[model samples]
Target: MQAAILRDKSGSLKIEEIEIDKPDRNEVLIQTVASGLCHSDLHFIDGSWSDFAMYPMLLGHEAAGVVQAVGEDVVGIEVGDHVITCLSIFCGHCDRCLTGHSYLCSHRQEVSDRPIGKPPRLIDGEGNAVNQFTGLGSFAQEMLVHQNGVVKISPDMPLDRAALIGCGVTTGVGAVFRTAEVKPGSTVAVVGCGGVGISAVQGAHLAGARQIIAVDLESQKLEWATQLGATHTVNPNDGDPVMQVLELTGGGVDYSFECIGMKQTAEQAFGMIRQGGSATIIGMIPIGVNIEVPGTDLFLGAKRLQGSMMGSNNFKVDMPHLCELYLGGRLKLDEMVSRTISLDEINEGFEAMINGEVVRAVIDFGT
Candidate 1:
């Protein structure tokens, strides 16, 4: 199958014919129907993030696909099922997984890759091992992943739209619905207007936030946010976004989300939250970058600064529920897809993401 392969940091993905292994016990082979080009993918492609990325890697995780085959040991999922792939793989027996916090499971690596002596799931035409990013790696025509990463969804859901739920939507919406649990009628603010940020706006809306403030430097994105669910938009170019948010929310918002993943924006999100409100950082701020907040406020005001990973999701439960929301016309997945491109056009998709030209550009592998 033809796949996009990245061999180095800060480099463009080159489309090439690659090799995939057959489904082993506990694995499922999926025919990639649609994969969203996410900012997390851009982070590794552009070298801003590289903690888990392996060279000669297949770098896509947010996707939905049709199951082509499943290993004999894989239970509860079968071939012909439509599913969304999640990177938050877990071992069911881990303390975190046993405690309903599977997203924080420590044994996740065991699910993504086989043991040391086993053959690799992906390889170059020459048979060199190629890492599948987060084990799904949907930038290609096919993927072989553990059942833990696959979430079966209603087949009626559009694969293209369902793809967003794997990551961006899950992270953003999960942050609002699961993590912070923003109260209905409360005021909320989200910084950044990218796909994930816009999804956060939708989440705030679903939570019934009375005032949804969207902040960004781009007017186009701010407009997009408003259409998604933000009751108000703020362009940082106009003035300090923190002050703007404070002014709009009377004193401050009940909750704030930092979706941009920058040190400055993280602090700004912290600054705009009400005295006792929480600020959830959903963006993947670079490793080693520390965000500093007011120390006195931590004690005096009882403010909270928290980090959310992949919206602290339980894929088996969350993905299907999210799909129902989309099918009912409640979740805004249609508007989230700015464009769809073929696998060969993958580089263009990432380029568009870097330029902030699209909300979520999906790769239609069948194309």
Candidate 2:
């Protein structure tokens, strides 16, 4: 199969014909139908996530596809089932999984990869191993992943839009519904208007927040945000976004989400929340970068600052419900996808993401 391989931290992905192995025990082989180009994938390509960089890596995780085959141990998921792949692969026996926090499963590595001595799931023509980013390399025409990493969804759901639910939508929406448990009638602010950020805006809207503020530096993105669900849009270029948000909300919002992975934006999210409100950082701020907030406000005002990983999702249940929401005309996955490109145009897609040219550019594998 042809796949996009990030051979180094040179900031570009080269499309090449790679070899994909068949499913192993407890694994499922998927024919990648649609894959979303996420900012997380850009992190490695741009060297922001150097600590986690692995060369010759297959760089996409957000995807939905048709099941082509399954290992003998796989159950519930059969050939021809439609599914979304999630990065939060978990071992059902793990403490975190049993505690209802499976998204933070401590034993993910056990299910994410094959045994060390076994042949790799992906390899180059010369027989060198190629790492699958988060164990689901959906940038390729096919994805070989653990059964635990995929969530079966309704076959009627459009695969292109369903792909977004695999990651960006799940992360953004799950942050509101699961991580923060954002209450209806609450005022919310989301600091970013990209794919994940826009999804967060939609999440806040779906959560029934009375006021939804979308913050970003780009005017175009802020416009996109308002069209999707944001009650108001904030462009940092105009002035201090934090102050603007506070003024708009009369002091601060009930909840704030930092969808941009920057120290400044993360802190701004903290500043935009009410005294007892919570700020959720959903973006993957680069490794080694630290986020600092006022300690006095944290204790005196009872403000809470925390991080949400993959929207703290339990993919099995969450992905299916998300599909239903989309099918029911409540979740706006169609509007979230700005455009769709073929696998060969993957580099241009990432470039658009870097330039903030599009909300989401999906790679349609033509499967």
Candidate 3:
């Protein structure tokens, strides 16, 4: 199989032909149909997340595909089943999983070169083994993943659209529903309008928010937010967005979600929350960056700051439900796809993402 491999720190991904390992007893082999090029992948490429990674790694996490083969113990999913893959694959017995926080499971991955019982998954020219990013590695035409990483979805849902459910959609929608638990008629302000940001807009809309405030610096993204379901839009550069949000909502919103991981935007999101309100940080902020909030204000206002990872998702349950929501027309997964490209065009897609020009540029792995 040929995959987009990142061997060095600061360059575009190079295509490499590599061998994929066969599935072990509890794993599954998937013929990848579609995958999304997400900003999280760029984080690894650009050195934002340099703490925990190995070189010559296969990089991709959000994907959907058809089951080509299944290991002996793999149940619930079988050959020909269509599924969406999530990186937060959990061990069901862990404390986090038992407490209904499977996304935070400590034993989500095994610390070994090869999966238990399966052969080593990848190797380089000198026979050096490489790690799979987030353990899914959907950048290639096929993937060998643990059963917990995949959730079977209806065949009627387009695999290309289903791919978004794995990351951006799950994170955004899950933040609104599972994390912040936005109430009906509550006011919401999402500060970013990328793939994840736009989905947060849609989630807030579907949750019955009376006023959805979409914030970003780009006019085009603001427009996209409006079409997705935002009741109003704000370009931060236009003026003080905090003041504008205050003016619109009479004080501040009940819930504020910071989808852009910048320190300034995180502060802005925190400032826009009303007294006793909650602000959720959905963006991946860099490490060692301090976020300063006034202690006096926090004490007086009773405001809260929270964070969400992959929408705090339970893949087995949440992914299927989200797919149903999309199938029912309540979720706008199709609209989130701005364009689709083949494996060779992956760099071009990444360029578009960096320029803030696309919602999501999916890789049609079938191509």
Candidate 3 lDDT (Cα, whole model)?
0.89
lDDT of candidate 1 over 263-330, digit per residue (tens): 99999999999889999999889999999998998999889999999998997999999999999999
lDDT by residue (162-194, candidate 2, tens digit) is: 999999999999999898999999999999889
State in Å the error of residue 243, model 1: 0.8
The lDDT leader among the candidates is 2
Residue pairs clashing, model 1? none
lDDT of 3 at 219: 93
- List the candidates ranked by lDDT, beginning with the highest: 2, 1, 3
Model 3: ten consecutive residues of lowest lDDT: 110-119
Q: TM-score order of candidates, best first?
A: 2, 1, 3
1-367 in candidate 3: lDDT tens per residue? Answer: 8889988787578888888878888788999999999999988888788676688888998999999999899989999999998999877888888999989988877621344664567765667776789888888999888888889999998999999999999999999999999999999999999999998999999999999999999999999999999999988788999998989899999999999898989998999989998899999999988787777667899999989998988878988899899999999987789889999998889999999989999999764
lDDT of 3 at 90: 79
Model 1 / residue 143 / CA error / Å:
0.4
Model 2 misplaced stretches (Cα beyond 4 Å)? none
**What are the candidates' C-alpha RMSDs?**
0.9, 0.8, 1.5
Candidate 3 local lDDT, residue 300: 95
lDDT of each: 0.91, 0.92, 0.89
Q: List residue ranges in candidate 1 displaced over 4 A.
A: none
Clashing pairs in 3: none
